[model samples]
Target: MPSEESEVVVVGAGQAGVAMSEHLGAHGIPHVVLERHRIAERWRSERWDSLVANGPAWHDRFPGLEFPDTAPDAFASKEEVADYFVAYAEKIDAPIRCGVEVTSVRRHTHRPGFRVETSDGTIDARFVVAATGPFQRPVIPPVVPDGAVPVQIHSSGYRNPEQLPEGAVLVVGAGSSGVQIADELCRSGRRVFLSVGPHDRPPREYRGRDFCWWLGVLGLWDLETPPQGAEHVTIAVSGARGGHTVDFRALAADGIELVGMTRSYEDGVLRFAPDLAANIALGDGKYLALLRAADAYVERNGLAFPEEPEAHVLGPDPDCVTDPRLELDLAAAGVTSIVWATGFATDYSWLEVDAFGENGRPDQRRGVSREPGVYFLGLPWLSRRGSSFIWGVWHDARYVADHITIQRGYLAHGTTDRPGLTPASGNN
Candidate 1:
């Protein structure tokens, strides 16, 4: 294999990698971005056909680069989002190598930096950025036994209602993806059952502003972590059908059956947790909390935003919450397909560094790792709540780039006074 060298090697040419390259180039840093496929490959391929970005175009993009002719509040479709990234890479002249996959990264045995092994060749660099964002791996829980459903697919594999087998469908997971898919399937005339779970239900638009806009103005996007006891809760909001508030009551009223969290499947029977009512209550509490915060902010600032009474209304509990079905016979229910929208997992097995904690996640402050030249990007809560968002990735990339520049400067000046490069820390 051929060998090359650069000051930095960025693994993954998605938003984080591209942003990193842009900021690094601006700092006169020599680096190369390696991607397994085309830029924004996940956005182009992994997402379902009808998917749109969760945030509005104006807020979801990198600074100064608008989605072409897109409405400020409109959520860009998956293709449009991917194309925007491709265009951004081109405009920045990013040194990205498509089709090059990083197989492994480890400390160089005979050098001070690191060695990155790739499908194409080897690259020795002083710093390595694991810009592989989250969603590296799809997590389909083993709740269903083998051959339990005639057809099964993760949310990533889902394309459209037409791609599914003709019958009732069960979407197991009530996150944004699960709810959106369930709604789509139901509207397409297929009987749909949504396996509800712990989630935060926020109105898509509130008080004449998008929920994302409210988060931004309220500084909630910068929250370092989830509120107590709500760490594992997913947000159940949607950009589908021109964006609307996600109300389980409304979904149930519209003919989509709602059920409790799935527990297991065996002998053609599926079991569910009896926490449907509790889960709905949890989400409602979060929603009300958000509304109260917004209302308080408005009162404090004396902003004359019209009061939304509907935002405070929680419609009657659907049957799923009032008297939930704890079990179902798959065959009797005629469910032929199952879509697992249970979320994603990270794969850092290729990284041969002691940067991960006991939880198997990178232990880093911001993007800086204890492992000297290694850094992580595009993980949720890396620096803030929005760290994994498109615009958030750019901010994080700039921070990482600035940190790298400072480290290089220290080395050039023969100084180890910086906190990350202190002599006792072993880099010296």
Candidate 2:
């Protein structure tokens, strides 16, 4: 196959890829964005039909565009989010080619650049930016016994309640997605059994403001530290009713049976760990710590915000852990569906180069990979917590675009450390 050349080649046409392409465009830098499917394919198809943004639309803006006429506090639907990216790409004239899957990206041995192998052809680009967002593959645990359930679906495959089986549903992993799915199932008059996990549950509204608003004000998005250990606690939130709280307690109150952590599924039976109380306490502790940290930031910064009122109905009592039936017979319980809302995995197998660390993730400092001319974006804590969000990648995208432009001259002419090679300056 013939090879096409560009100044920069970005993989994945999601929010991060679009942002990177936009910045490169703005800077008069030549680049092309390659997508495996249509633009924003994940948002277009992976999410449930009734899904909406966990955060308000106003805060989800890219650098040069905002969801026009969207209320500051209103949440956007998945389709709208997907459409926004399409419109943004058109607005910025992003050089994006859809249905082009990148097979591999490796450094050019004979040149100061990279050779990107794609389904369409090969791309000989001076720089390559991997904007494939953090969640590349859905992670359903192997403990889920095969053929134990009649129907098994990952949360990404779930669409709406009407699409599910007629009986009860078992939702594993009680993070934001799990809770939201359970809530929808309960509201749809389906019995929902939610397996609880240690996840953060910030109240939807706190001290007369949205929790996300407080997070923004308190600079939680600016947090640079990644979650320690294998258990990375994701934000447990919901975009239902514009924006609301979705937690295990709320799900339980909504008639969804709260169960302990899932252990194993064998012989038509599902088993749960007996650590229900401990899990609830762990989640509540994290929630309380978040509130305290926000308050501390306000006090230290001397920022004037509404004073937090006396504790109200924040969450369910931690000790109110119900010792429900730990072992559930799949057939006897009439549980016809299982939705695995169990997080995702970062797959860099297509990169075709050794760039990961002991953690099996790219060993990069803020998107600047160790491999010359190779970069990464749209990763959690790539620079800050926001790096994985829609509004956040602009920072890292701008930085990477700048880096690419700075090294463009050197890559083209085999020059090194030559002074006064300023990047193509445009909007910052």
**Residue pairs in candidate 1 whose N, alpha carbon or C atoms collide under 3 angstroms:** none
List RMSD in Å for every model shown: 3.2, 3.9
Q: In order, how many clashes per candidate?
A: 0, 0
Candidate 2 lDDT, 1-428, residue by residue in tens: 77777778899999999999988987888788999999999997999988888888878778577787568788888888899999999998999999999998888765456778989898887778899988899998887676777788999999999998699999998777888888888898998888887777777776667777777887777888866852377667887867775556656676888788899878888899887777777777777777787778778888787876543345544333655658989899999999999989988898876667878889898899887778999988899878888888978899888887777654445233555432322101
**Each prediction's Cα lDDT score?**
0.89, 0.81
TM-score of every model versus the real structure: 0.96, 0.91
Residue 67, candidate 2: Cα error in Å is 0.8
Residues 184-281 of candidate 1: C-alpha lDDT, one tens digit per residue: 99999999999999999887888889999899999999998777877667889888878888998988998988889999888999999998888888
Model 2: CA > 4 A from native: 294-320, 412-428
| Top candidate when judged by lDDT against the true structure | 1
TM-score of 1: 0.96
